[model samples]
Target: MPFAPEKPARLTRRRALAGGAAALGAPLVTVFAPVSTGAEDQLAIRSDILNVEAMQIAFDEDFSTLDVSAWGPGTRWIAHTPWSGDFGGARFANPGERSPFRIVDGNLRIEARRDPEGEWQSGLLASVDPDGNGFSQQYGYFEMRARLPEGPGVWPAFWLIGKDRSTATAEIDIFEFYGDKPDGYSSVVHVWHRDGRHYSRFHRNAVFVEARPDAFHTYGVKVDPDWIRFYFDREFVWKTETQPEHRQPLYILLNLALVDGPTRDATPDPSHMIVDYVRAYRLD
Candidate 1:
């Protein structure tokens, strides 16, 4: 439980910074190629398998109402990870009157702020609870549309982990945004074997890209038998070979966490990530 897809600071952050916006100009026509001969932008669906557009929405949460419980049997979401591994600087609080989540208009706002005693508290929502009750799928397209909170000490992310942990944990971090680095975020895939033998330093992956401030954008990933592809606003960014360890169904998780950083850059008094939706899709 201690192992998670955090920053990967020493191994990949520097490489990510150096990677820069290399994915800017080139058209990374991955799994599905946009083969438009002339005018309108359209894609030529390969004869092989599935594409994002051709998939059916299996789960959708617009946050119209909060159907969450601290831990659940019938609730739509749980307040903590199923493994009970709550990382980052702030405490992932349970759902209560003082909970750090709210529905503004139709969006879910995850807040991170200090308590009266100066301790930080924030929100985390997992699609599956400790008892393994909730939505999960073998392979699918998972996405979240949101605007992240900027500035130092804030850490927000959307990620996935395989359901069966009897042998290992297959984690795919869709995105991890560190406020200090406002222009980009991190995406890592980890295979945490029970013995810590497969959790190698070389397994950490990261990326850097442009994320305009205060604007809502889509962050997504497509998981298939061959590769795990990442996207920003539907634009292909990167991919990795699908790990064999990811054989079990995977669940969704998102959180607004704080980094225990320098005192000079204390967490914003009240910071939040406004997420418009969280949805998952399966091959139609």
Candidate 2:
């Protein structure tokens, strides 16, 4: 489910009317075409692997504005996780003037810093709320292009959570970066039933790739019926068997978190994770 965004210098979002299909649970994509500003949407993901026309854009967020509201009826994003489980060393703060989210130069800056009360605060955005009022898809290509913050105790991630919680909770971690280990990141697939069942059969992959502090990089996952494929900067990196629990509509979440453990150096007072875009695509 997508809402059309204003055309900034970097990307253009054109909306198409979608009513009947939306009523039937199909959310239309706010179609996007790349602008000359940068390599934001220039990646050709599955042209050679699958039919080009088979995939259609489902969701797109260039973060022109932080469209968030309370965990109620009508917001595109909820500030915290739907289950009220706020993770990491830093607290996930509410959206406000002193909030961690800021739209700077057509990008979303998720800042990790201390509030006036001397408590650490950061940002997290989820596409779905507890009432199931936002966007979620069973299978698609989801991605985020971002410039990570580097320093001790800083943690950033882009991940997904299955919407149905009747039996189990499924998670697909696209990438989780620990600033303490700036040379690489990790991808994990997890499933845990309500009664603490089916937790061991999952994939935990550690990807070894050096990070350039000044440049932005892309991290993504293509979730199909049989496979969950990961990509770095449009280059395929890893894959695993898609779990049965993961075959349901899953919501998106991206955040800047602080590590819970101690580190050698001080955490950056005002660290930031600059996100260019978070998007999704579904194959026909």
Question: Which candidate wins on lDDT?
Answer: 1
Name the regions of candidate 2 deviating beyond 4 angstroms. 1-54, 198-214
Candidate 1 residues lying further than 4 Å off, grouped into runs, are 1-51, 199-213, 263-265
Could you tell me the TM-score of candidate 1?
0.79
- List the lowest-lDDT window of 10 residues for candidate 2: 10-19
Clashing pairs in 2: none
Candidate 2: tens digits of C-alpha lDDT, residues 40-64: 3334334314332467889989888
- Candidate 1's displacement at residue 95, Å, is 1.3
The alpha-carbon deviation from the true structure for residue 134 of candidate 2, after best TM-score superposition, in angstroms, is 0.5
Per-residue lDDT of candidate 1, residues 1-284 (tens digit): 11223443222221211122211222211132222234423442232223567789999999999899999979999998886666667878888977999999999999998888877899999999888989999888899999999877788889888888776667787887777777677777666554433331122123334447458988888888777777777776656667787756999999987764462146677999999999999855
**Root-mean-square deviation per candidate:** 9.4, 13.5
Q: Among these predicted structures, which one has the highest TM-score?
A: 1
Tell me model 2's lDDT, rounded to 2 decimals. 0.71
Q: What is the lDDT of candidate 1?
A: 0.72
